[model samples]
Target: MHGKLTPGLDFLSDGGEMGALMRAHDWSTSPLGLPERWPQSLRTVVSLMLTSKFPMFIAWGPELAFLYNDGYRPIFGAKHPHALGLPFRQVWSEIWADIEPLVKKALAGEATYHEDLHLVMERNGYPEDTWYTFSYSPVRDETGGIAGMFCACTETTQEVRSRAALKEEQDRLRELFKQAPSFMAMLSGRDHVFELVNDAYLQLVGHRRDIIGKPVREALPEVEGQGFFELLDRVYATGEPFTGSSVRVGLQRKPGSPVEERVVDLVYQPVTDREGNVRGIFAEGYDVTERVQAEKSLRESEARFRNLADHAPVMVWVTEPDAICTYLSRSWYEFTGQTPETGLGFGWLGAVHPDDRAWSAEVFRDANAKREPFRLEYRLRRADGTYRWAIDAAAPRFGSDGSFLGFVGSVLDIGDRKEVEERLRESEAAFRTVTNATPALVWVSSNDGNIVYLNERWYEFTGQRMDEAVGSGWTAAIHPDDLGRILPYWQRCRETGEIYEGEARYRRHDGEYCWHAFRAVPQTGSDGTIERWFGICVDINERKRWEEHQRLLINELNHRVKNTLAIVQAMAAQSLRQVGDGSRPELQAFQDRLFALARAHDVLTRENWEGAELREIIHEVVEPYLRQSTRHFEIEGPRLRLIPRTALAIAMAIHELATNAAKYGALSVPSGCVVIAWTLVPDATPRLVLRWQEQNGPPVAPPTRRGFGTRLIERSLAQDLGGEVRLTYDLAGVVCVMDVPLSDEGGMLEHQSSH
Candidate 1:
């Protein structure tokens, strides 16, 4: 029905570009015929539509021939040129069901309007989610009968999606504010209007529910005269943040309650808009009332006590129940030249001769734990850093109600008496002869705890003369780090008059440090006063190393157990996702892999998990299947050892291959067989090559897609053993090849084990 067409009619001539396309278009392939035969109303409507700039489309006749203006052409996307004259239903078949009702309504002379309507369309090659706001109206004929529909549309996808995203972000912000731990609120404008308030802020203000739209002055009127109002005004005018630490404020926490005093650490930060103009304030703070009150009470108590102790002749001190020094009298500070701040909380220990501090702290802590009165003598550091002997006595104090409070102590200087004892110890010639004859190193100290003598063995082992090893000079032979700990314990034992036993690393005559156990016993006079101390040193280095090695082995075992459990967890999680509940083929396959791993572990465990022989791993995995069928498998490989990780990976791979053969390849047939072999390639870096080839099975072809077995073989071997694997489905058989690095832990153990 091809013919030359003339277009001189009023409607045809008036129609713009689309009208020209419809008139010149071929109608043979369409349900609608030539334009000359189209209804008068349809031609008139198309003529008016093509000249309009607004997006508009028309569907004409019972067949609903589609027509659109140039402004609406982009709505067709890639469907352009051909969509102009096509039936409306076919042109937009993907969304035809969604829009057909609206088209029918318009044809019935009932107009419809939609705002932000959701639609999924495939105007292009692929479907897209789209939103539109449009109106549909009926087009009339000369007989005043509705023939078709007209649409004026506007796309609203971007606007609608942007609004939804903005709302979601606002909700997220509100949730964050509501759950914040600190009291937080947003105040807007110069009046500090409460724009938003979080739960913590509401609780802070005594749970007042109606405070959100009110100014801070109206919501919290009690804070007006507390200087907080002034602070807010200053911040709003200058747009600078204000921070207050432990600031006192008066507040009415409830509707009809008396004003209460509270302390708070607060900050008022300014929030700015896109233009960099500050618009509102963000208030954040935490209440510190209890901490502030406790500190105030402690200061008052310390002031009253210092007045009485400052002029006391003896040094005085006080400690908390935990043995942390809380206060020291003026006499004690003057004697040690340490400030109250430095002397508090175990800090005063720094003034003790470094060697004696450790032992003194231990004795003091022990006495406090038993809550008993005790007396001890130790060297203390004078203001000039000279060590002086001092005797200290302390008694635990309790309240009138018998509740344990803390300890109160006093100290007396005893350096003068210690000098007299040193001269008496020097006159004892018989004591030196007996100690010098012993093989052990020996030393003696005076009543004042100063070293007075070193035996011949002591001088020989330390590579020092008697003079150099006497007094505090012997500390030079003690390792620097060990001296800090050992000196304190030795001094404590001397002061407490207890048997001293301690360990230290002492520098030997050869310049190497070795551990030694030192023991000392005090000889006291009839008056119960210590006259001298006798000590001996013995080597104990070998025992220390043996203990350290045992610890390392136990830690390594724990790490391996944790790693194995994690691997099992990952395998179970993946298997459960694929198979779900009940027994299925996927579940059975996972069980086989799990059992293969267990058998590999059993072989390694038998060897203490250091490693296992490679042949053992293969035999364990394949033995079960080989015993069940008449088919046989040829196994041959060098006797190489495999570390725990490499052994497990190989075991799993072998199990997968054997199972596949049983299901669809070699082992499925009576005459089928499998050959497994491996060889070692030696060099600076050795490698192991393993091959699995099936034979005498049904003709094989490569699978169309990968299965679970293929993925496992490829991923596990590469990750666990750092190996490469290639699986090929040959026409006559299925073959697999693998290459793995050979580490010292997985090197050859013996010759081939063939079966």
Candidate 2:
């Protein structure tokens, strides 16, 4: 198949490099056999194609064996070497359908030509988009019958792509221009020939589509004397931009229609080349005739007496320069039961109540003469024959030239507002009367922190004059040391709108300083803004002295009680000693119980005997247990402050429970623990639920006998608290629950309770 240059391939000689390749090519497996077996016509065509520089190929015989010249070698790409003698369809299978018909026509003796034909070809191992201009001609065999096709082609991909890109960019720009909102046009050369016009330009020019490609002068003949032509010429000649605002122009926009005058804001900008030479003028503008005409209509109608309102919310009226009524709104007619006949001119004056007519007329006349705005309240007769209050207000209207036209006025129904005003005055008067009669000093302060009013009691207390007692001046009577704390506290309360309360000393008229309780509450408006502060100062000097005396008496009583308990403890000790050593342990227990009572009383005294926190009382009785090496007690509950009597009873009960626990219960073992928790049960009469649960303790049974300590815990404690007490002896541990009465007003009480 691959021998030295085959001497039999004489026809392939002197035909370029493809001829040499053909001579050395294998012919044993080829359907065409070899170049020597090829028909004379095919040989001649191949030879001619091989010597030519143009791309050329030949398909010969029934196999239509493919062959190509050296000039077309690059088109074969990776298909060379084995492609020379392959079947044409196999060689170009990717584009076979497209070229098969042409191949058939050529073989049937018909020649064909295609210019810039598009194709997708698989060459060089990948498919590529390409274009070609080619011709297919039939070639005759030795019998003078068409047997094969020959083709000559040239790739035109670059040229086609360049043309396509240019068209795409042009289309995009044209679309942008057509969609522009402003009228735009391009005129070329000195004559200003129309080159392009967008849709907006056509709309502005009455939709004349035939203007493109025509000279501006011929296209818009109606704009001959409108100065547009002159402006366009000047811009084109001098290469300068021309801008005009509200320029007047006349146009015969439609055929057989009269000329319509229009106003426009226009700009003529010169279009230039890269050389900076002007080539054309671009025109852009907007039509503003509607705005101009609207302004003109407004001035004309309002120059003298205008219908300023017809459907206003309130009654409206207009007057001429001479104070003659000209017009009234529909509201006025409906309200006053008058129409054009009775409401126009001075007839409207009849609607005013008889009692107010003279003064109302004089007020209107004086204001109209002075060209002033005035508001006045007067009684006006309604359609139902009722005279209702109304607020009449009017302002002078001037024309564009500053000439006074008339007064445009409105009347609003103030009947409701007048009633409210009367009620407010009565309320204010009542407030003053009550304050004056009150036994304490009262003051009113504006939201700005300035005291605006003070009752007579304040002057009586401080002996200051009315002017001195009101406003910031009243601070003069305040104890000098108290002002520093009061001012900042008052300021903070003013800022946060919180109620303010404090005890401050004020100098009485007798030159004595007395403690006074000062309380101020904010008066808030509907919108949640504080409008003012109302305050009172009550004398508390007597209460203060009484409380001090009570405290001193309680201290003295406590000291005496402690002394008596010590005396009794000593007496019992001495009696037990006399009775012998048998009662010694009982005497020790008695002393411990006394100490527990003393601790509870100590807690109460710290709070001035007012109350004691339940937590504080529990800790006091458990102080001995808390010092142990291990934690044998766990107590938790909400914070609660108990009255003195309740504190004493609860402390005694807890102390007894702890003593029993240490001797025979949870505290007897290292693993044993006591968990005590309490909670409030809210009910008609709220109750405190206290639970003492012992865990991991020695087994328990009912006690053989009840001791005095147990009796005290079960009976006396429950009676003192006005509740129930239960103690259980389960096999596992000891449990105690005490339900005690709490104060009824639990909500107002915080964590502290009056139990």
Query: In candidate 1, what are the lDDT values of residues 1-755, reduced to their tens digit?
Result: 12444743456554566656766778877666766666777777777787788889988777888888877877878988788777889888998899989988998899999999999988778879899999999989888988788999988889999999999999998898898878898999989999888887877778855887899998888787778888888888888999999888877777788988888889999888898777889999987787688668757866766776777888988888888888788888899999978888998888888888999889999999999888998999989888899988999977534667789898888898898878767756667777888877788888777789888887778898777877888999999998888778777777899888777888878998888888889999999989998888887788767656655664566457556855775677677777776456766777677767777876876666667888889999998877876778999977788777778788888999999999999999999999999998887868889999999999998998999888888787876567799999998899999887776654444433221
TM-score of each: 0.37, 0.55
Q: Kindly give the stretch of ten consecutive residues in candidate 1 with the minimal lDDT sum.
A: 746-755
Clashing pairs in 2: none
Clashes (N, CA, C under 3 Å) per candidate: 3, 0
Q: Highest lDDT among the candidates is held by which one?
A: 2
Candidate 2 residue-pair clash tally: 0
Q: Superpose all Cα atoms of candidate 2 onto the true structure and report the RMSD in Å to 1 decimal.
A: 21.7
